[model samples]
Each structure stands twice: as structure tokens, then as C-alpha cells.
Target: MFTPSSALTLEQGWQTTGATGSLQKLKKFNNQDFNHLRTSCLSQGVLFEDATFPAHVSSIGPNLLPEDKLRRIQWKRPTELQRNPYLIMDGVSRFDIMQGEIGDCWLLAAVGSLTLQKKFLENVLPKDQGFQDGYAGIFHFRFWQYGDWVDVVIDDRLPFLNGRYLSVQPRTSNEFWPSLLEKAYAKLRGSYQNLHGGYLSDALVDLTGGVQMAFSLKNPPPDLEEILKAADKSQCLMGCSTSGPLRRNIEVRNGIVQGHAYTVTGAVKICYKNGWKHIIRIWNPWGHGEWKGPWCDDSPQWDHVEPKCREALLRNKDDGEFWMSCENFQEQFSWLYICNNTPTFLDFGDQHCTKWSVDSHISLWSPVLATGRNYSPGAVSMNPQYFFKVPDYDPKPYNIVVSLMQKHAEDMHNAKTLKIGFLITMENSKVLEQFSRTRDITKYFTLSPGTYAVVPATTEDQEFEFLLRIFMKNQDYNENSNFPPSPVLPMDVPRQNQDRSYKAVFLRYTKQDSAIDASQLQQLLNDVILQDEMTSLGGRFSFDSCRGILALMDLNSNGRLTLQEFGRLWRSLTKYMDIFCKEDRNHSGFLDVSELKSAIQTAGLAANEQLLCLMALRYGDAARRIGFSDFVCCMLRLETMTNAFQNLAEGGSQVLMTAMEWLTLVMYT
Candidate 1:
């Protein structure tokens, strides 16, 4: 359903310096969607449906595609293939790969790397697709694009030479998935030529949406083994590229191809020759070129190895897989890439460890605003910002990890990565201050419990989508970990004007150059109600509700609410408003039992089932309805009791009160 307007919207100027806009947004499709689209096209008597396929996938007249210039190409479906005619046969594995005529070794190497993570591979290559499920001459695959999951569909038509897949294919002849996936990816970009040569790290990120970190094996870190072991535990896909300057094709030395990408399947410490030896297993995407060094297939070193160990690691028959010592690995591989996936939920510490609350935001930075070329005069606020609140319950510091990623920058910019960075700032009620700034995409910081703002930005002017994930480790924090009490008034304001409600009313009255009168207040209330569906005070704030609040705050006993009275009312309800917002999960302007429990717990109070039921029974009507007013009253009393306890604790009182004692104190306080 991509419309003309959608295209124009994508063409809008961001913070870019050139008029050459980004490519058009490709129409997305899923497995089921592609089937439906195919069905519709077939019903319309269309022989070819190129809507989801690349426009210039095949050459016109007698010409051939750039990648297929040498090979005779023919369009065929999976049914025509000989062998296992399933998209995924015998599950996904490194043996499923077969590099074809295309010079996309980097992509194949990444695919091989993905096979190392079983859970992650299932996510990338969903199991919902199958030719026998319902053949419609179409298939789909999902990829992590920018900050979201995008499904790309393609017609079953694939380029073939004789009866074989012309490009990358699986080792099994009938498995057409690898070929089809490569086609869909080529279509994602403008053409297959665009993907000719690229970094395996870039391909890995595109496939998994994981952050890629490159480590130089030349000067290997002392903790290289520990790092790799940790990566394996985290399910990170690992790959290594031979060291050397960029060249078309480096020479193959001792059966190891220089400047070629290889998958690092595992790093293991095994007992060998009456001692322990550190070894690394690597797989070449070509499925050939076995390493001729030690521990290689048919190497004499295997003769001394334990029978079980040799059998477990023996997959030798020219599959391009080999094992070498960790020392040899450091000497052979130049650059190692670790693509680490971010887990949705993360816990820190052991049994007494702190739990973390995680949240993410997807945003974009425009060169349009980066150079102050937009409406604003100064540098535009291209920096994306996020805020998180840490309660002051514990004096111990909390840890936070902030990761910022700019999506598809390498692919879009011709294998050139975008220069992106971020700044995380800590702020208090009184002032804003710098906490830390880092050019690294991922950074970990220790922070005291307070409200902190995180702003992610690019090092230069560029417009691209980015992902910002913040992980805050707390004892047992909830979604409200980032929400702090809103400030409505400052200390410099006069005591009389300190009341936010009164100040708001005076401002409204002054805007019309009038004084507070009944008619003016009534008119304002009417206007507010008409404009807003509901007020923070409650669901459907009626005229009577407004009057009741005004009357309660009218300390001078004035017939009409004055500015000071309104200010006092507003100031008194600030915390209540915050509670209401938190409790109103669906923003229904009311709180149910579950939401009430959440609010109580967030306020640092006991929220057991019995206590919640008792509060609901006491405060709600027969329908169990807790309106905004009821919520405010309950929170006010609770806050008063909590303040008393805090005061006692701060006053050097180590005494602990029982439930009955607490009730008595609350009843009197």
C-alpha cells in the first residue's frame, strides 16, 4: 500500500548536503502476503509478477544480467529443482551453504557464521515458509532493516544454469532457499551488482540487527579467549578475515585463502597429549580449501588426540572446515568480527543480583537540521534524547548500558559506514550537566539513582534511522523506572504563586486580560473539556468536578476561585497526577486492581493481593471503579504515611514497626 505521498515523504530533505536523495522504499511482503499477492496476480491472468522483484533483474532482448553474463539464465521454480525441494531441509546449518558463480563470499561467510547461533538463526530464517504448505510461486524472508523487522518477498522464479542454481545455493541440490534469499537481498538493494563486494560484518549486522565489533588479531588482547568464550555464551556470531591491505584476490597460503572471510564456529579448551590446549574451529564458506596446518583433517596431530575427541571434531572430507590452536588463530586471522545480539531482558549479578528495566527508541538524524538549515537558527537538535529515572532508595550506584546503532548506513553508502556517536547526560531538578560522551556505539556507565537524559547523535551531518536501547540495572524496577515527578513550579516563584493550578488559572485569565470570576472560570473549564477528552483529574471531568476542586482550594472562602487558590490546587495534585498517569495503563482515566497494585509498588509501598483487595473494597464503588479523585485521595494518605516513615528513618530511629503499629501511626498521621 505504498502511495505517491509515501514516496514524497521519503524524499523530504533530511540533514543531508546533497540533492541526490536515498533510493525508494521497497514494497514489503511476508510469506502469507506473497501467497495472496501471487493468487491475485494469477487470477488476473498475469504470467509474470515483478512487483516484488527487482525491476532490472534480467537483461532485455539478448542481453544478460551483469552477474550472469557468462552463464545462460533461465527462470524456474522450486518444483523444477532436483533433490530436496524444501526451502529448509534437515534444518539450517553451515553444510547447507554452497557458494556459486556470484562473488559474494562475504555474504556466504556471514551466512555460515549465522549457523553457529541456533536460536538466532531461527529468528532470522523463520520456519513459516515451505513449498508444500501452499505453492503459489512465491516465497518470503525476514531481515532486520534499520530499527525493525522487514519481510521481503519474491516470486519463486530464480536464475538457473542448466538445472542448477546460478548464484549461491545450498549443498543439497533441491534446497533453493539460499539462492532465493540471495535474490531477495539483491532486490532489497537496487541490484545484485550493488552487493558484489562488502564486509562480512556489515552483512552480519543486516541479517541479525546485532552490533558488530572488530578486534585486531595481530595484537591479540590478553583476554582474547575469555572474550570469545563470553561471546559464545551470548550467542554472538563470530567471523574472521585474513589480514592485509585491500586487494582483488590475495594468494592462498598453506590452504588458507588470504583476504577471505571465514566463520569462527567455536573456541574450545580441550585435553590433548596429557595436557590442555586452546583451539579454535573455523569454516570456510567455499566448502573447500582445508587448512593444511596442525589439527587439520588427516594431520598427524589427530593420531595422538583422544579417540572421542578426534571423532567429535572430525568433519574432514574437504568441507573447508578446520581446527587450529588459539595461538595459530591469532597469527592467521587479521580482523575478527563479533556480532552481539541484544537480549530483550538482561539481569545483573548472581542470586542477589539487580534486575534491569530495558526500553528502546527508534529515531533518525537529518543533515537537514544538523547544519542549522531548517527553521531553527542555531544547530538543529538532530540529537535524539531519552530520559530515565532512578529512585533514591539505595545509596549504591546502578549500572546502565546505552547502545546506539545507525541502520543500513554501510549498504546505503556503498560499504562506507556512517560516523555516529552519542552523549549521555545526567540532570537534576535544578540543573543539567554532562555525564559522559562517547564515539563508541555501545557504552556502559555507573550512575547514581536519579533522572538522567540520554542523547544520541551522529559525528557529522547525515540522515538515517538509528536505534537507542537503554538498560538500567535496578533491584526490582518497573516500567516507571524512567518517569520522574513532574516539576510545575520553581522555588523563585512567590509563595502565593507557588500553587500551579492558581498560576495556570491566572495565566489563562491574563491572556484574555481579565480577572478570576465565576463566568471566566466556567468558560475556561468548558474550553478545556471540549478540547481534551479527559483531564488528569479524572475520566470526563464534569463541570461539578471542576467546581468541587476549586471550592476545596479556595482558602480565602471567595465565591470564585482566585489565581492563588488555583495555584495551590494545581501544586497539591502534581504527585496525584503522576500516580494517575502511571496507574492508568490504558489511559482510561481510572485505575483497576492490577494498575493500582503497580502504582502502589512503584510508590515504594506493599502491594500484596490482600492489601490491594482491601483498598479496592474500601475506595471503589460497587462496580469497583476507582476514579481520579479516589486515586488522588488514596495516594495523598499513602504519601503522608511514607513521609512520616522516611522522617523517622532519617531521624536516627532504628525501630521497626509492626502492621498494627504502622496502621495506628498512619491513622493518626
Candidate 2:
């Protein structure tokens, strides 16, 4: 509970919206400031100033006893609802929430499930708030939106039908937290009408800054018991939904409501006379309709248990809470949404909860002209890329998780959600290795200590804003904000002198006829090679190195290089040299295992353990090493493959690679 003397101004609120700021500098809210902010906002006669409510509310006609139902509507503050409107009644529990009319049981179910975690509930509702003790007509709640916990303020004007709350009701009349929270959420989305229906995972994500994963009951994981144990250990919030078209309060064939969401409150293995029975407890938001099968209230199974044991179950009448066997639960629910609150980093024996450092950027995806695809080339590279540097020497085990979230469409009521997906690749020496695909907005990968590039893109051509999030244990990155750089490669040529020299070298080597034959190209390679340079292999350039360079430069077997083609090759080689020098930390003119990994990653390629091992075996010397010549060979092969991929994008002839060509390219490279 927090009670600030003055509320944050509109501009101040806007500044807090995911702005870069010191964590220590943040004005953290507590029980006292919760009430303070509300009082301050009320005194100013302004709604809570936050992004959720960017503007004033619009006017809409209210109906009493309209066609939908026979009832009148009223608006009231908490004090008006009761003499002592404590934020919560006796205790916050699933029973405290009851769905009212709206098809937002998914959200209400999340609220109900959230109560099981006391700390999380406090973070959202702030126990210090109530109608008494300097009452105000405004209240505030916090929601985890995008990558930040945002404070949303709202007036305590709740809609009531026939003198009772309309959207969501409480089990007890004095318990106003459920209805008030619903109203605040409704206000966040613009209006009460916007809260009609939504996914449970969406609501859970808003309530907790946890990763959401949904499991389809139709193909449940075989290791479900282990997954559930882990989820319980992490205190994950869980909910279930049945399949079928939604009809208000309509029960399906076996007394279970179709298309209704339910909270998974508890899982237990209780002992019976013969053995043990695994039971799972679920609560319906409608406050009615429960499983009446075995393990349920009044079931014969209870007869075997002692009176005290049976009393512990606390079976209640029509409370919308009931226990069914885990087996039955599988048959009843179609989908299960689990909000995993597990810390992304390793737990170092600390009892306190860990909060992940979250950062996000808003960008859009557009169609690319790859594979001869329609639309713009600029759009084809719509994928945003991020670079992460992981030190290779850390002893502790670590992993990285990337999540891609697209903004919600405003026409959610009528329009269907677009199918969105992304792929993550790690930079191998010259090639990008496919790592993970975006699934459930979260993907995990085991990585060695090195710099890695993550590219997230839409599976199809569509323009829409999206958010990318990175979660890692302990790491740092030298972020180069510009991604998908222009093919002209301006960023690579930062030094004017070096650029001029490289260009002069290319001009001097080219024939006056603006082209050179194979012999002249060979002479150019020899000229570029710096002899008398001590190599990691204890010698100067080798015959094999020269041959590799020739094979790489002669892209077309025409035995000739046009000035334009030679220029492209020269630029690519220049870029490669810069990257190679940065990776060759010892100035050894060769790459060891660790150095090779770094070199591959710096080149924007993904390298897994298997791939790294193969590279070491294929290219490393008898001393288990890779010379500069081999490195160049790898780069050329990758460039060739990339060109082929681009040709595929252009709808050109199918790219072909014969076994002999593959062997000749990879064996020596």
C-alpha cells in the first residue's frame, strides 16, 4: 500500500513508460503510496495519468432494462458499495471472484488464480487501499505491460446492474477488489465493452511479468507430472479453458461450461485406504457448475478417509470449487495456460524472488523480396537482429531466452489474430546456424561463451509492430544498433585512409581493359598476400592458402574477373579481414577452438557444439588449429551459399550443390 502526497503528472507518467532509467532511481510504490497517488489524483479531479488512459473518456448512453436483460444500471464508489469497503474481504481466494454477464471469465479466472500467490497479488492490488481511511474516488493498480510494470489509475466508478456489479462480482458484497480490478482493466483497454473476451495468457501476462506457455490437452506432454512439479515449485499461475463456441452460462454435455475458463488452484495426491489418488482442484468463474464425478464433493471416495482427513478437504455446496481426479481434468480441459514465474538466471540459494532486467524496442515487420517473393526488398529484411556477447570462460551454466511479442490488434472483437512466428540463428564462421523458432513467445537455447546474433522475423509478409525481449544469466553486449545493414557496407569502412588504400589496391591490380584473365587474378592474389609475416604455423603464406584464395575469387569458372566483380570480391575480403583481426586475440594468424567460435559469431553465424566440433575436425591442423587460409575458405563458402539463398529468393534457378563440389569447398576450407 502506498499513499503519495502528490500524484505523478501526465508528462511524468509518460516518461515512466519503458524509458531508460536507473533501477535504484525508480520511485518504488508501497502500501502507503498506493492510497497517496489515488488521493492526489482525486484532489486534482483528474483520472489517473498514465498511458492506459491517454485521453478523457467518451460519452456513451447507458440503458436500464435494455434488450439484453431486465435490469437498471448504476455507478458507485467503494464507499457507496459498503460502509467499510476493504479492498479484499477476509482473505483473497479463488472463491472471492465471480463472473458477471461479460464473456471475460478468462481475465476473471486469472485474477482468481493470482490470489493464490500472495506476493504477486499484493504487487497488483496493493493491500493498503480501501474506501475507508481518507477515502478517494480514484484507485490505481499495476500491470506488467510490454517489458515494464506500469501503474494504471482509474476512478472508482464501477458499473452495476440492478444495484449489483455487472462485469465481475465478489463472493461477498464487501469484497470490492475483484470488481474494482476488472473496472481498471476495462479502462486500460479503452472501455468496458473492450473487456468482453480475451485469452487467459494475455491477462496472466498483464498481471505477472512471467513467461506464458500454453499446452494443448489434446497432445499433453508425456512428462506432465515433472512439468507440473516444476511449475508448482516456481509458483506458476495456471488456468484451463474448454473448447466449443461460447454461450452465456451454458453448460456442455457433462455439466462443464464450454468455452469457459477455470482456475487451477491446487494439485494433490491424497491417500485412500488402498492407495493414493491424484486430484486437481479447479474453480469456475461463474460460481456454479462443478465436476460431479469421482473425487468430487459427496463422492464415495471420501468414505475411506478419516473424519479429520475428509474435513481437510472442506467440501462446500455450490461454491464453484471442486476436486476431480487428474485423469478427469485432462479429459475436461482443452488448453492449459501456465504463467511460469521462474527466474531466467540461475538461482544462487537466495530466497528472495528474482526480477529479470527487461528491455524492448518497438519495430515493424515488412515483406522481403527473398525467394522471388512479392513486395519490397526493404520489407524482406524486416527481421530485427540483436547481438549478445557471452564470455567463454564463465564456469557457471547459462542460457538465453528470446521472446517476440506483436502488438495486439485493435479490431480484436471482429478480426482474427494474425499468425506470427520467428526464427533465431547463431552466427557460425561464415554461415548462420538455425537455433530456435519463436513458440509461445519464448524460446530457450544453450550457448557457449561468445558473441551471438539473434534474428527475429515474421514467417509471412506482413507489416506490424512487435516487441523483442532478451533474457540471459550474466552477459554484456557491445550493441551495434544498426541491423540488416545496407549491402553497400558503409559501417565496415570507418577509416578513410584504409578505405582509400583498399580501393587503390583494387584499381592498381585491374587490367587497363577493365578486366583481368585468370593469370592476372592469380598475380593479384599473390600481391595481396603479405609474405615474410610470421604465421601461427611458424611460416609465411602456403601454396594451399593461395589456391584457396583463387578458388574463392573465381566465382564464375570463366577464368576471368570483370572490374565490377573483382570490386565486390575485394570489398567482401576487406570486411572479412577486419572481422578476422578482431577475433584473432593473440595475433596468432590462426584460430584455436575458442577463437574460432568467436570468429564465427563475429561473422554473424550461429555455431552449436556439434557444428563447432565438426569445424575443428575438418579445418584444424594436426595441432588442432585453423590457419588464416582455412578461415578465408570458410568465409568464401558461406558467401557462395548466401548468394545461392538470395537467388532462391529471387525465384531464380534452383540452387544446386553436388557431392564433389561440397567436398572440394568444405574439405579444404
Candidate 3:
């Protein structure tokens, strides 16, 4: 199985000085160091071959990789036999090293920066050749506030709960190392979580023992290069400098920056047609701050400010105090130091923010019409005939005012006074109360965006529809004048007594004819033909048989055959057969009575012998020669009778009477 013991090794030449101790004592004092060693050994075996790297590792940004060969690394799980037992990597700056969730990032960055400061990397790092080795005499790094650092003795055992050891299976234990590292960093930063709660500046302050500051993305100072160098040199405790006019006030009290602190993390380059622009990356140690500067290319401040504002503001070297960069800088000189950091140009391509708007209307009264001497009982037709068009503006809240008016017809001859009430519907659905008479109608109602109101007047005996007019006016407390004419269209009311002549004519025709017409009769014949064609064995003899038969019968070639045409064809064929053949006594080409009977028997209709006899009698001449017309008529009559009988059997005596009436009409017509 894969193990971490052979994966990473210390630098070739390094040494440690300390007495060896038992693993139990090491576990009691420093479990994190031991866990780190164990994880390293596990990583070696699990990730031995380049192609065996873990999926998560491969998924990291490939462009950021040190070499292309690392891309194809293979990963596997470590077995119990190949585990490691040490804490620190050899030949590295341990003082600056930090661990994140893997708890190593802070330490790593610190040590990485310190290694940049001095080339004595091997002196600070441990001397383990394999995955685990005891770093015996390295002095512990101390935090300024804590005043001292705790001794981190090497150990080989990890923390357990309820006196029970955790399972060392790779699947289960693989996550333990990273989690421990994360916890350590969280504790160092004084934050409980990664994304929230703690201050990022506080972590930096604790780690670096220096004052921290945050800058806005919108209005960053143009002299950022000077400020960043100053920060690196530890010249200013905290600074705020800009190349242009101050966008907002910096609220500092008692010579200290309060609430939160942040530090510059990285730089980004933004490119345009002419050249590239630089933007500094500032992170709030607390992880939250208001940087009222142009964060991205489309920042509004970027549009208003001049290109000179993107340059570094001049600073005074003699006093080392903060300075603001503006046209009136000489007059507003103060004892403060404002430093600008180095500019990092960002390549954030084609990103922008969009804005939209909304509008609304309020109703004066309910739209429901009440029953009275003059008003109708049903629902009032208060459908607004008007639409309110929203203007091109930003979404904001505004109040609407509605007025009510009632008028009575002044006629001495008519005794009753018209007492009409107004009902209103907002946005065509939200109903308001009815107002009977003119009152203080200027009632203010609040509305958001995308709303309109519909108002109508009605009385007790008759429901009258009215247009819902709308108007817009300024919201001023001192102004109490009439509003201007509404820009929206006037409401349209539909008349109740509109003409419907076509409907009346259709109803009259429907009442006159209840029987099936030519169209329906043809449909029934076609349905029967289709059913016969589908069910019979002979129907499958040819693919186009049904289509050919239908076409032949359709005299007009309009893709349909009428019942009259079908009946006529049957009659003509029967008549021709009867006229050409005499009654054949020997049952030859001409069918005699007995030969017809035998034919019926062979066709499985012998049980209806009486019907067969009647058919033969109807079709045959006095000389006993059968005619096609008579034969067709007899067959049609028998089929009609069978249908009538079946309907009667299922529907009882009433259907039987109806069938009789239908048959009589069919035969006579």
C-alpha cells in the first residue's frame, strides 16, 4: 500500500540537538506534530507514481503547476506499515512557516517570506531524510502579544476520544491531517471559521506584529506604489493616500484605525486598447471592509476621475506624515501619512453590472358593486379600459393619490336622484371599497413598480362601466395642486348591448334539423366500409384495395364517397345480374332458388333461412332469374335490420321504436 514516508525528504545536510523521549510523552504534549509526520508518510505511498496523484491535487489550477510532469501523477492509498512519525520538514525556515486547514499555509508563507529575507533556509528547517524525523533543538517562534511561544515537542500519536484510537484505514484517516492543519491556522488567526466571523487584519497583525489597513476597490489611491513599498519597509503604521480628491472621509479616532484591518495581498493587471491598468488586491484581515474605490473596470468613480488620479501622490520625506493628494493639498495639509501600494493590473475580461426599474398604481375603493334600488345585483364590470405605461427610470417606491367624484342628474321631471358609487380595481384585480359621494379623495397610497388602477361608477338598478384614468405627479408636501394630464392611454369600456346577429342565426338553424344530413350519412357509410375492410381476411389481399374501392365510389374524386352513390352502385349491379341469368335448375351460372339457398348456407347465414328466402324472392324474377338491383336492395335491407335489432336488444323498447322510424325513412327516401 502507498505510504508518505518516502514521498518528501529533508535537505541532505542538516542536524538537530535533543535527548530522545518516549512516544507517549510526545503524544501528550504535541499531537499535531506527530499527526503531520504520519500524514507525510501516508502521502508518499498513496502518491508514489506521478500518475497516482489524488484527483483533488490534479484538479487544482493546472497553469499554476511548477512542471507538466506533475500533471500525470498517480495517487493511491497508504497501508498501515508505511506510516511516518515526524513534524517539521528539514532545511526550511520554520519560524515563518504556517499551517492552514492543512494548517501549513500561514507557516509556509511566513517561512517563505523569511527565506526571501535571508538565504539561511536550511538552518531554520528540520533534518529528516525520510518522511518523519525529530527536530530536537529548534527554538519556538513567539507572538508579540502572547510574549512567548510554546515548545512544540515531536510526537507520534494523535488525539482520540473516550480513550479509543481512531481507525488508521486510508479511506477514514486521510482527512485527519488537513483538518488538523486548518484548525491550527484558525486558532492563529483568532477566527473560528474560514469564510466568516474573524478579522483578516487581526490575523496578519498577530502573524507579522505590524499595523494593518484595508483599501477600497472603487477609489484606490494613484500613489499605491509608494504605499506598498512603505508597508513592506514598515514605515507607516496605517495610511490612506490618493492621487485625486478624497471621495469620502476617513473616520479615524485617537490616532488608531478601528473596526477592521486589512493588508494588500496581490496585484492584478487590467488591459485596454492603449495599454494595461494596474489595481492592487487588498484583503481585510477581518475579511470585510468598505473600499470605496473602483474595484473593477466599470466602476463609476473610474469614469469621473482623471487618468492622473491613477498615478502615485507625492509624499513628504522629512516628517514621514500622511498626505492627501488633491488640488487644495497645500491648504489642507495635516499630520497624517497616506501611503500608496504597488499597482497590480487585472485581466478580468468583459464583465459589467446592469440596473433595471419598476412602477405601481394604488386604488381608491373596492370594485364590487352592491345591490340597491338603482344598481344590478351581480358583480360590477369594473374592468379598467386604460393601461399605464412605465417610464424609463430606476426602481423605487412612490405614493399615489386617488380622488372620488359623484354627480347626480339635475332633472325636475325625474323624481329619483342618481346616487352612484365609485368602485376601483388596482392592476385589474386588487379591488377597493365603493365610495357613494364626493369626499376628501386625495388619499395617499404607497406602490412599488409595475402596477395600475381601474375605477368605475355604478348604481343600484343598472351596472354602468366607466374608464379608469391615471395621472402622474411630483411627490411634494408643499404642493397641493391638480395633477397634469396622464401620459397613459384612456380606458376603453365595452358596451353591454353590442350586436350578436351571427349567434342568433346559428341557433335558429340548429333547432330546425336534428336528423343526419348528406355529410353525416356519407360519414356513417365510410365508417362501415372501413370497419369491414379492417376485419375481413380478404381485406389484406392487397395494400391499396380499400383506397381503390373508395376512389371508385367517389364520383367527384373529392376523396370521399356519398351514401347515395354507394346505394346506386349496389342497385345497378344487382339489376344487371338478374336480367342476364335465368333461374338455373342445375345451379349453373344462373342462380336458382335452391342454388341461392345453398350459397347462403355456405356463407354461414343458413340459421337465418327465412331472411334468405325473402331475399331470394325479392331479387328473383317470375321465371326465377335473380337481378342485381333486387339482390342489392335485399342485402341492404337485411344489414339494416341486423343493426336495428342489435340496437333494440341493447337499448330496450324505446330504441326499437326509434329504429323503426329510422328504417321507414331510409327505405322511403
lDDT of candidate model 2 versus the reference: 0.58
Highest TM-score among the candidates is held by which one?
1
Candidate lDDT (C-alpha), each: 0.58, 0.58, 0.30
Ten contiguous residues minimizing lDDT sum, candidate 2: 1-10
RMSD (Cα, Å) for all candidates, in order, is 11.6, 17.3, 36.4
Compared with the true structure, model 1 gives a TM-score of: 0.65
Estimate, for each residue in 1-669, the C-alpha lDDT of model 2 and write its tens digit: 000111111101111222322222222322124556766767886544334332223211222135444324556666666777777667787788878866788788888889898867877876555666655666777776544565556666666666766678877877778887887677655555556656777788778866666667777866555455555556778888887664345686566887678888877667878898777778888887888788778788788876887798757689888888778888988877777544322332323322333323444555552211222334333345454444454423335556666554343323323445444444433123222222225554556766554555544555545555555543322234212112111222111212222333444566224456655555655556433252324333356654555566666766566544565566666666677677877878777888877877787755556556666777667876777656666666655654555566578656476433443455444
lDDT of 3 by residue, 1-669 (tens): 001011111101111112111122121122234335445646564322211111333222233224543344332322222364223333222221212212122232232333332322222221332333422211122221211122232212222223322111111232232222222332222221221212232232323322223433234445444444434443222322222212122324322123222233333343433665444433222112223323322344344334555333212121112222221221221211212111111101212221111111222232354432323223433322222333333322322333332222222211222344334454435445444322112222334444343334544443222212233332221223222222221111121221112111111223312222334333432333223321221122122333434444556776544333443433333333333233333433345566665544443333244544455555556756443323334434444455556676687655535444454443333
Off by more than 4 A, model 2: 1-72, 247-249, 305-310, 343-363, 366-382, 387-401, 408-416, 426-440, 443-453, 470-669
Model 3 local distance difference test score: 0.30
Better structure of 1 and 2 per TM-score? 1
Task: Residues 386-459, candidate 1: write the lDDT tens digits.
Answer: 65555555523325666676554433433234556655455312122222121125544556666665655554
TM-score of 3: 0.21
**TM-score for each predicted model, relative to the true structure:** 0.65, 0.57, 0.21
Candidate 1, 237: how far from true, in Å? Answer: 1.7
Candidate 3: which stretches are off by over 4 Å?
A: 1-131, 135-196, 216-222, 229-276, 279-669
Give the range of the ten consecutive residues with the poorest summed lDDT in model 1.
3-12
Error of 1 at 602 (Å): 14
